[model samples]
Target: MSSQRSSKTFLQLKYGEALDTAATKKSITSLLSSHDGTEVIHHCLKEGARWGMSPDSEEPNTLEAVYILSGKLKLHRPNEGSFLEAGDFLAGQPVSEFIVLTALEDSEFLYITSNPVFHYYSSDTRNLEMLAIEIEKKDGYTADHCFRIKELSMLVGEKMELNSESLQKLHFGALLHDIGKTEVPESILLKPAKLDEEEWTIMKEHTRYGATILRKTNITHFILAAEVVEQHHERYDGSGYPKGLRRDEICLEAAIVGLVDSYDAMTSERIYSKARSKESALTEIKQLRGIKYHPEVVDYFLSVIE
Candidate 1:
């Protein structure tokens, strides 16, 4: 099942490519993943630096996601607005003749670009992010639940030796897995009270709704993510989910997310439950084994946790 690991390439943003040479500049960009016209990049920007997203450049039509990897910087509307600290993601298309960046300090970013899908999925992708923020606002404990799931899912994905495309899909799948929850009524979503059987049934439909939303968005690349979203609540033993999918029937990414989702659920406090100790959570996960999760996935998850 192993494939040739994609080569990671280093690239320099030219005078007008990523940095406005006319303005102050110092920056570096690395290519992380590229498939189906999308490129994932790692960018490092230094102090007193200014970068440009000129609509007249080589890759001008690119849709980009800039996630601050480290350090801090003031960024918003090329020359206007406030600072965005590390961990914040800025997504958009080139809106002005030249959108420039001024670094308040040395900063790094993770950029995801897809010339094709960016046009269609850009707004939706960012919208989902906003929804995630709303979820955190509604439940403070889940401040970065989607991000955590993406991180943990990627960790498991790497352990499984997933190819670059799979990893990318897994990453998106993990991030938007809970987007369907947006449809759930706030009265039930933020009830702070035990949900009755009907409510529980409605809650379980989030997976189905999530899958539908991903597909309906016309994000062709996200079809994989759609599958993961739907199957994430499924069990290896044919018990979990709206579909009762069993072993091997569920996609690998879904299984990975399912295991981690449960792990995180057990270890993190939420509107419905209190957090379990790490050891206690791990113990419960271990006990589930072949019952709740895929055996190989469980083994890999256990190995990573230990």
Candidate 2:
């Protein structure tokens, strides 16, 4: 549809007519941004198509109904991907970071937008950094430790060659991995000796608490990062924490953060343990392989360090 014609503002849009011009990219890119008073739109796509959209930061509130008229689509945002089939419908101010739409097969969809239920701040890292500073205050070492993990996790992610969206989520998630520990008692967190089973239980609860905080923020980016926060402790062989989720059940970003976190903890001094040589930590992690860490993540991590 021609932008000039579409701009005429007709009461009705005929077939093949689009309220907003079709935005295309080699893969994914931003499709829309802030505009004047309530404007509803319709988009149509053919097979092998992809589109990404972001809401206005100043007015983050938006309610939308998207119906997949035909074919299949993979909607990716931040750390999650949603598969929409023909007849599937999604509603709400449902965008964070951005919405990625990819046609798995020949596809077409219709969307209607309206006022949103509530407004939320757009993506920002400064707020999260301040929160991290506060959470890390309890332990002098962790401030630097978390940053190291973040660097290594992103390095691993880059080795794996993740897309920008995946890398962003991985970076933030790795930095916030231990944020949940803030909720636990310092007695258990700062103990110089091994934690008793009871104290260990409280330590384990950090994942749940951390994810809860991210979810409560209602910010798309952090909300997307919550998967890593909650699942970083889960093991590849179904043996790790708050949940025993195994294999692909764990989010890849979370697994990467977990592996890096473990690697950093081993190499860095902590109140409860002596620092191990980098070589030793690498050897120990290599031994765990698929048993403790995701095999692909381990391999990529090794390549990154090597």
**lDDT of all predictions, in order shown?**
0.66, 0.65
Error of 1 at 237 (Å): 0.7
Q: Write model 2 residue lDDT over 79-114, tens digit each, in one string.
A: 455689978987656343444465777666665554
CA error at residue 300 for candidate 1, angstroms: 1.3
1-306 per-residue lDDT for model 1 (tens digits): 001011011111222232122243356755677788887767788774444332313444556666877887654342235566788876665322323344678888776756533233234455665676566557435556766686688667766766544555576688778878878887777888888999999988988988998777544335547888898999999998989999999899999999998898888887678889999988888888889889899888888888
Clash pairs of candidate 1?
none
Scanning candidate 2 in windows of ten residues, the lowest lDDT window is 1-10
Question: Each candidate's TM vs. the true structure?
Answer: 0.63, 0.61
Candidate 2's C-alpha runs over 4 A off are 1-124, 140-142
| RMSD vs true structure, all candidates | 13.3, 13.0
Error of 2 at 167 (Å): 1.7
